[model samples]
Target: MVVQRLQAAALLLGPLIFALSPFFWVDGHYGITGGTLIALSMVPWVYGLIGEYERLRERVPTLAGLWLLLLVIGMFGSIAFGLQGFFEGVFDITERVSLAALDEYPPHSLFLLWLPGPSFPLALLAFGVLLGWTRMAPRWVAVLVCLAAVAFPLARVLRTDWVAYIADLLMVLAFGLLAWRAWHRPVAAATSD
Candidate 1:
């Protein structure tokens, strides 16, 4: 029972955890040093959602299962992109010697713009919509997820990176709320008859 609940929360947590830079935005750590832990964290985030979808599949069927599968893939892809982009920038600096450094590679607004920014929001929003439709997560989380999807792109349209940051903060809040709700919910006993 406890394990089931933990698994459920882990599922909701996968994508959000990935976004919080599951791979540490670690500095001075060099190459795969500090980044390895960050990159490795993606495993749980990916499978977490997969496991959750398995549980959800028994309940929500239909498009919900499909959405969950896509989200799981999308979540992993986002993490990979972030990792690859960061290190690629690192290697570029090393090869160039003087062209630039990691710090200068992925600029302040690189993620702050482009399709890269929407991937997570789209994932979250899709998950939220699916969960909300099933009443698995608090309804407000679904609203926020949809809002994030809309806001991030709109902010970029308006030329405001702060909107992206704000969207990120909201996602963290949604994750916290989902975790808290799941943690507090009464766990059904595996032994209960």
Candidate 2:
């Protein structure tokens, strides 16, 4: 019961925090405050993702497991990215200099940034589809989740605040609905899976 509540809280809060982060961005850069929020958001986001896996695992064990794995990998990459922003803000490092330094380490760059980065959105896309397929959520919820998944990567890559905001809003709505359902569900039903 406690775990369910925690997961629900995480689901609601994680994306909310992340959505608010852009408000802290200054001069086209995530300052220390924004970076910190991004990093912190990942903690609850991870918990929420785990809870999502738990819900889906009984219906589709293999796909759920893969989604969880991908999400975790992508989370590590996100954390690294957030920390880089924090450090850059603290040290007054330019984006060009930071990218140049990171380029010097090909393996680190590939594993930490490039490879795992896409996994987050990809996993979300799969999760959204699975939610609809398994009848775990409404069709509109699934659609919103998929939209958010696609928007997330594009928002970051394009550095578009409006798109990011939209993605964040979609995430909040979709996850918020899931959390509400989880919270209101009978204990037996929640545990049965």
Candidate 3:
């Protein structure tokens, strides 16, 4: 009971914190505060993912495994990306200089930024589809998750505040529904395993 409520809270708060992070940005950079928030947001996101995996694993073990793997990779990459702001802010390094330094280390850049960065949205998109396929969530909720998954990456890559806000709103709506359901209904009763 307590665990479910906590998970629900995490789902509700994670994206909200992420959405608030943009307000902390300074001079086109997230800086320490914003970066901290972004990094912190991942904690709940990870928890939510784990909880979700536990819920779905029995029904689709292989697919759940793949989803968990992708989510972990994506979160790791996101953490590194978020920490860049912290490091830069702490050391007073310019974005160009930081990027250049990363460029000098091709493997680091590839694993930390390029490869895993894109995986997050891809994983989310997969999760959305899986939800509909498995009937774990409503069709509308799954569609919203897919839409948010697509919009999130675009908003981040483009650095568009409005788009980001839209993505965040979508996430809150979709995930919040899931969270609410989780809180109100036990998974065992919600699905037939």
Clashes (candidate 3)? 0
User: Which model scores highest in TM-score?
Assistant: 2
lDDT value, residue 189 of candidate 2: 53
lDDT minimum window of 10 residues, candidate 2: 184-193
lDDT order, best first, reads 3, 2, 1
Who is ahead in TM-score, 1 or 2?
2
Q: Pick by lDDT: which candidate is best?
A: 3
Q: Quick one: RMSD of model 3?
A: 2.8
lDDT of 2 by residue, 1-193 (tens): 7787888788888888877877777565666887888778989977977877887998999988888888888888777777777888999998789889989999989998888878777888888999899988888888888988888888777766777777778878877887787777566553643
What lDDT, from 0 to 1, does candidate 3 have?
0.82
- Colliding pairs, model 1: 23-38
| Residue 92 lDDT in candidate 1 | 46
**Distance from true location, Cα of 7 in model 2, Å:** 0.7
Q: Between 2 and 3, whose TM-score is larger?
A: 2
Candidate lDDT scores, in order, read 0.55, 0.81, 0.82
* Residue 7, model 1, lDDT: 56
Cα RMSD, each candidate: 7.3, 2.0, 2.8
Please give, for residues 1-193, the per-residue lDDT of candidate 1 as tens digits.
5565665577456536434442333332223432343355456555555644654686778775667655655555455544554665566444234224434756643543233445655766677787788787768777876776566445433534455457556755666666666556575554352
